[model samples]
Target: MRRRAADYRRPARRRLSCWIWGLLVIFSVAGFALFVLHHNQHQEDHVEQTALETNTKNERVVHKHLNFTEEILSVRSYARQLAEQMTLAKAYVIIAKEHNNFHLAWELSSKIRSCQSLLSKAAKKNEPVSLDDAGPIIRSLSSLIFKAQDAYYDIATTMITMKSHIQALEKLANVATVQSTVFGQLAAESVPKNLQCIYIKLTAIWLEKNSLRELADERRNSLQLVDNNLYHFCLFSDNLLAVSVVVNSTVSNADHPKQLVFHIVTNGVKYGAMQAWFLGNDFKGATLEVQNIEDFSWLNASYSPVLKQINDEDLQRSYFERTKDMSLEPKLRNPKYVSLLNHLRFYIPEIYPLLEKVVFLDDDVVVQKDLTPLFSLDLHGNVNGAVETCLESFHRFYKYLNFSNPIISTKFDPQACGWAFGLNVFDLIAWRKENVTALYHYWQEQNADGSLWKLGTLPPGFLAFYGLTEPLDRRWHVLGLGYDLNIDNHLIETAAVIHFNGNMKPWLKLGIGRLVCSTSNSHYPEKLSTTLPQIINGSMVIDAKGPRRSLKVRRKMSSLKYAIKGNQFKIRHDIVVSIQRKSKREM
Candidate 1:
């Protein structure tokens, strides 16, 4: 029995040995094939193969070209040389700020910046040490470094001031006297007496490039977040802060009362405290209470993007899709180009636990002092949410709307509607129900002929204005861009509204050639240079956009006594008989 068992086991052992040998043979063949492919003696015919090792070695040297350790010192020596050149350029600008040639400093400043930018890119790409690396180029250019830096900063600062104006004004005397006091400063500013008006010219360039008022508004808004107009909300916060101090006392393990108070206030009890009876940990003061912010947005005011046409179809589609259906059309007239823009902003009790209101300002506006006074305003009953325009002040479209459908309102005044009038705050929810925007858009699409003759949308505004004509609770509305020179000081005083009505933009052919920028306005002197040639003093000789041919010239040429310049009028090919025939044809 033992021999029989041994014979069976011998067969199994032989089979296992055969399997192992097969696997070894397969692996050995694969290894030999891989070795033959990898070592690759194919370099015998190719020149690149011989050069590969040297090329790789050179690349490594280039990688460390500007580093502390390197086989080649020239690469690093060059980057250092460039850096030194830049330092010298910076030094020159510091010295030449007041000189007349200060503008020449820009050459050095721009070059330095460009070199730094290009150098950074080359380093990122691991480019080889060469002229492109900047070191060699700067070394050659270093001779001018001393002269260049002298005027650099002065010119740069001058250019920046001409464009970016965040120069804070010192408000002398009490802050309360700001309004009237500011007017004096505006009027008292001395005009430049220079023949060329260089400062004025620079101011125009700045205004054209940047929006000064917009920048100032943003800066003010950011600062206002720390302390805005929220009396009731602030009081509530103060109360909650006091309660937090009380709750923290029992949880702290502080020894003395004073230290305990500080610990409770600063550290807030140990956050991962264990329940007195339970074995596991528990959290204290984890529940958070958040307050609502006062949120407001301008409604039903005109947006130029809605009224303007940009040639870009894709951009138009994006704008159309992004904007909700705030229609710009009236029932009477359909302006094909105008747009209706609106966005939703509301106080959500769950999202913003702090109970309150918020205000959305139109783009063209100036906030004077604190907005606290306006926050306290309330319409009839307890209408906490309000829009000043709805009080019957801001209606251009509203007037037109009422005129379209006389039945919409009995007292409808087509002329008085949303010309500059605003709408109710609470009415936003009600306005969304009727889809009036869609109705206007449909009216516009059906009748649009790309002309401004009819009232497709503004008619409803007039109707609405006539129907609901009431003075706004507070004084604010859709305003013009300082049309009433008496009421609006535009650049000098804080404005409630600076309506950029239609095409009366300061930059346009109108408005005396001024452009509104972020913090200030710019005037164009070159407008005269370009347009003066066209300001003809005599009767027009040629139409501006027509062919140059004159009726008189055509008639006079036809009456000429001699043969005309272009044609022989008779066949020239043949024979001596052609001269006589040609003369008769010319006659």
Candidate 2:
């Protein structure tokens, strides 16, 4: 039994041992599999962590770029606003000086300083502004701030000088009851004797001309017809000869010459002369009506604020005396106030209320091509369509404006383009809606206390039309033809309108002669030299021993005859060709 029990126990034990071995193998396999699984899970977890870290770094870089872009945009907007404010502040400074308001100027200066400080602080942030990105703007604003400060100091100085002058005048008033008449006489004697003679002669001529004023009203009622098909041209001129040229040019260049109607406005003295010239000339296709400036009901000294501002005795005296400082041609100077005819264009809106649009031409301009195309041009809702002048070598805005005043420098771009006023297309409806006339009045009032501009109606036009100007084709208006001796003949030929902007008019003695810059041998007529003023008489006769160059010859030649004599060039018919020889000293 023990042996049998032992065998049974042994088999059971064997079975149990086998079961235990199998269980152990299963446990080992399970353990290995679990270990492999755990290793794979750990690798995945490490990859996910790495990916998260990379994503976070990328996001930070993207945020930085976005922040930088936003900051740059903010800086640009701030800079533009600051520039505008600076310009206004500069104007206020001038105003303060004019009104003797030092407190306002001081307050403005302090505000400007504060703005500078804040702007500097905002610009100096680390990692906030990129030097490469914002460097240009930052530098410009910084420079502008410095310039504005300097302008403030200049204003202060001007104010001080003005105050001194006022005090001196007050002292003089107290000191001179007895000596006043003698002092006045002495001052009168200080004027150049030649200048005094010329002034007196000119005044006499004007007085004599005025004595012959015609009571006959111009034939304006006949010209204004119900038909809307006629092409209208408006002009304000005192020169009958110039008017004849303009009318002839216009009539010849038009496709429908008979359909043209010229609305001519002149002073009381010139109305009769203008009508006589027009009638005698016989423009077969064109019709013109001459009206005196006094005929315009809305036009008076009280109508425009600009007129009121400049109508003062002191202002008129200053303007008349400004010729010396302005370096104007002595012959062009007038002892009286600036011509009221110059200010007439400002009333274009009221002058032609029934007309929708019109092109305003300066008397100095000569029309070349057909101007009917001007009527067809799209103004893009602008009140004025004109050629930009800033592209020219000399006719920049800075050439016209006083940039030393912060107001001028800050408010306007020194490089901001300016337009020529000689040929302008005005949209009357747009002008009325924009209230441009009112804007013109406001600026004129600002300039009332102190002279804001040096000369001309164009500056006021620039301010009034500011953003409302549309840039026309440059070929439409070619400028500086009178003063720019070096202008290309091809440009003149191609231009729609040729403008003689300076003192040397084509009608002047030397004007047409100087058109051609180079010549070999030019013969000038002796009579042409006589046409020149006394001031220029001696200079016109060239020294033949040195070089046979320019001799003021005033002989009338119907056609130019060119003949070459060896190295010498001869121009027949009194056409004076002045050649400027290169000096040996210069070489």
Expressed as tens digits, the lDDT of each residue in 440-496 for candidate 2 is: 888777666544566567777878888999999999998886668787777776788
Backbone N/Cα/C clashes per model: 75, 13
User: Candidate 1, residue 111: CA error in Å?
Assistant: 56
Assess every candidate by TM-score: 0.24, 0.50
Q: State which candidate has the highest lDDT.
A: 2
RMSD of 2: 24.8
The global C-alpha lDDT for each of the candidates, from Candidate 1 onward, is 0.33, 0.59
